[model samples]
Target chain A: MGVDERRQQLIGVALELFSRRSPDEVSIDEIASAAGISRPLVYHYFPGKISLYEAALQRASDDLASRFVEPPEGPLGARLLRVMRRFFDFVDDHGPGFAALMRGGPAVGSSTTNALVDGVRQAAYLQMLSHLKIEDPPARLELVIRSWISLVESTALIWLDGRRIPRAELEVQLVHDFAALAAVSAAYDQEMAEVLRQGLKDEPGEGPFSDLVVRLVALASPPAV
Target chain B: MGVDERRQQLIGVALELFSRRSPDEVSIDEIASAAGISRPLVYHYFPGKISLYEAALQRASDDLASRFVEPPEGPLGARLLRVMRRFFDFVDDHGPGFAALMRGGPAVGSSTTNALVDGVRQAAYLQMLSHLKIEDPPARLELVIRSWISLVESTALIWLDGRRIPRAELEVQLVHDFAALAAVSAAYDQEMAEVLRQGLKDEPGEGPFSDLVVRLVALASPPAV
Candidate 1:
C-alpha cells in the first residue's frame, strides 16, 4: 500500500481498538501486532501512542459528525428521527469509546481531545440548525439548541451505561426532549416561540413532535407574550 | 485532636484539595502537609493515598446526599426547589470533585468510588420518593423519577463545564425538568396522573408547580381525563 494508504489502514485498526477500550488500555505493540505491522512501522506511521490515539479519536469524531448530518428533504420530525437513529446506531456500535469521549476528563479530556470533541459538537449543532431551516437564531434559540445537544449527549451516555429503556423508546424520548426543550424555550422567549412554531409546522401533524408539542402546549400557557 | 476528630479533619482538608484538583493530581505528602501533619501520621490514619482519596470522596458523597434531604415540609415544588438549590450549591463548592465524580468510568471508575457515588444517587432518589410520599411506585413512575435524577446530574455536569446560563436560571430549568417529565408521565399513566394531581395540590396556587400544572392542563386536555 502507498504511505497514505498504510497510515489510513493503521488508523482504522486503532479506531476499532479504541472503540472497544480506552487508549490507555491499548498499547502500541498490540496495535502493531493487530495491524500485522512491526512496532517500528507503527511508530513510523505515527510518532507515538499519543499521536496514534489522537488520529483514532479524530477519526471517530469525524464518523460521529457525519452521522449527525440529516438529509434535508423530509418533515422535521422524520428527519430528526432519522438523525437520532443514526446517533443511536453509533452509540450501539461504539458504546465504550462513545462513553469515554462524552464523560471526557482526565480520561480522554486532553486539550487536543476536547477540541476534537467540540468540533463534533459544532458540526452537530450546525447540522441541526440547517435541518431546522434556521440560521442566525436568537441567543435564547441558540441556547435552547445547544442545550438539546447537551441533553442528547448526557442521555446517550446514561443510556449506554444502562439499557433500562429500549432503543425505540430512547429515540422517542430524545426526540421529544428536543421538542420539549424548544417548547419550554418558546415559553420564555418570543423568538424561540416562532422558531418552534415553524419547526413543528414543518413536521407531520401526528408524529412524535406534534404529540410532544400538544402535551407541552397543554402544560405551558399560550406562547410567551 | 482525638482520633475520630482527626480523621474527619484530615478528610475535610483533603476534600478541599480534591475540590481544587482531581484525586490523582493530589499526592499523600501534599495532603499531609496541607493537613499540618506528618506523612506517617497521614498513613497512620489512612492506609495510603487511595484510602485518603476514597475517604474524601465518601465525605463529599455523604454531604451531597445530605443536601438532597430537604425538609419535606413544604409543597413538592418548594421542596424540590430547595433540594435543587442545595445541589447547585454543592456543585459550586466542590466544582472539581463534583466534575471528577460525574465524569465517571475511568478516573473515578473504581468499584469503591462508584459504589460511594451510587449511594449518593440512591439517597437522593429515596429522598425524592419520601417527599412525594410514594412507597411503591410502578415501573413507569420509577423510571420517570430516576430519569429526572439522571437529567439533573447531566445538567449539573454540563453547567459546571460552561456557566453560559445563570445559576438561578439553571436551577429553575432543572426544577422545571422534573416537573415536565412528571407531567408527561402523568399524561400517559393514570396512576401517575393521580400522584401528580395530589402532589400539585400540596403546593400553593401562586407557586411555580401550580402554574406549571395550570399551563400543562390547558394544553393536555383537563387533568388527563
Candidate 2:
C-alpha cells in the first residue's frame, strides 16, 4: 500500500481497537500486529501511540460529523429524525469508542481530542442552522438549537448504557424534542416564532412534530371517564 | 484548629483555588499558603494532591447535589425555578472548577471523581422524582426527567463561557424547558401525561408552565399580515 493508504489502514485498525477498549489500554505492539506491520513501521507512520490514537480520533470525529450532514430537503422534523438516526447509528456501531471519547478516557486533557469533539458539535450546530435556513438566528434560537444538540448527545450517551429505550423511539422523540425546544423559545421571541412557523409549514401529519402536537392535545383533553 | 476543622479549612481553600484555576495548576504550596499552613501540614491532612483534589471535589459535588433539593410544595415550575437559580449560583461561584469537573480535567478517569459526579446526577434525579411525588416512573417519564437534568447541566456549562445571555432569562427558560420536556413526553405516555396534569393543577397563571402554554398558543395563532 502507498504511504497514505498505509496510514489510513493503521488508523482504521487503531480505531477498531480503541472502540472495544480505551485508547490507553491498547498497546503499540498490538496495533502493529493488527495492522500486519512491524512495530517500527507503526512508529514510522506516527511518532507515538498518542499520535496514532489522535489520528484514529480525527477519523472518527470526521465520520461522526458527517452523520449530521443532511440535505435541506423534506420537512424539518423528518430531516432531524434522519440526522438523529444516523447519529445513533454511529453511536451504535462505535459504542465503547464513542463513550470513551465522550467520557474523556485516558486522552482526557489532550487539547487535540477535545478540539475534535468540539468540532463535531460545531459542525452539528452549523448543520442544524443550515436546516433551519436561518442566516442569523436570534439569541433564543441559538440557545434552543445548542440545547437540543446537547440533549441529543446526552441522550445517545445514556442510551448506550443498557440500550434501555428502543433506538427507533428515541430517534423520533429527539426530533419531537427539537420542535418542543423551538416551540418553547418561539413562545418568548417573535423571531423564533417566525422560525418555527417556517419550519412547520412543510411538515406533514405523519411527521414527528405533528405527532408531538397530536400527543400533547390528547394529553390536554379531559381523562376518559 | 482541630483536625476535622483543619481538614475542612484546607478543602475550602483548595476548592477556592481549584475554582479559579484547574486543579493541576494549583500546587500544594499554593494550597498550603492559602490555608495558612505548611506543605507538610497539607500532606498530613491528605496524602497527596490527588487525594486533596478528590476531597475538594467531593465537597463541591455535595454542594452541587444539595442545590437540587427543594421543598415539594407550591407550583412545580416555581420549585424548579428556585432550583435552577441555586444551581446557576453554584455555577457562578465555581465557574472554572465546575467546567473542569464536567469537561474532565486531569482527574478525568479517576473512578472516585467520576462516582462523585454521577452521585450528584443521581441525587438530583431522585430529588426531582420526590418533587414530582412519583414513586415509580415509567421509562418515558424517566427519560423526560433525566433529559431535563442533562439539559440544565449543559445550559449552565455553556452559559459559563461568556454568560452572553442574561442569567435570569436562562433560569426561567430552564423551568419552561422542564415543562416542555414533560409536556412532549406526556403527549405520548399516559403515565407522563398524568404527571404533567398533577404538576400543572396548582400552577398559577403567572407560573412558568402556564407561561409556556400561553407562549405556545401565541405562536400557533395566525401571523399578522
Per-residue lDDT tens digits of candidate 1, residues B153-180?
A: 8677767766766777767766777776
Candidate 2 residue lDDT tens string, B156-195: 8888877878899889888888888888777776677778
Query: Cα deviation in Å at residue B24, candidate 2?
Result: 4.3
For model 1, the docking class works out as incorrect
TM-score of chain B of each: 0.90, 0.96
Local error of candidate 1 at residue A51 (angstroms):
5.1
C-alpha lDDT of residue B192 in model 1 = 71
Model 1 TM-score relative to the real fold: 0.76
> Candidate 1 A-chain TM?
0.91
Q: Return the lDDT, model 1, position B196.
A: 74
Instruction: Give the lowest summed-lDDT range of ten residues in model 2 chain A.
Output: A102-111
Residue A53 in candidate 1, Cα distance off native in Å: 4.4
lDDT over C-alpha atoms for residue A101 of model 1: 66
Question: On residues A53-113, what C-alpha lDDT tens digit does candidate 1 reach at each position?
Answer: 8898888889999998877886887788888899999888888887776655444656687
The C-alpha stretches of model 1 lying farther than 4 A from their native spots are A17-54, A71-75, A100-115, A129-143, A161-164, A189-195, A214-225, B17-54, B71-74, B96-118, B129-143, B157-166, B185-204, B215-225
Tell me the lDDT of model 1 at A8.
95
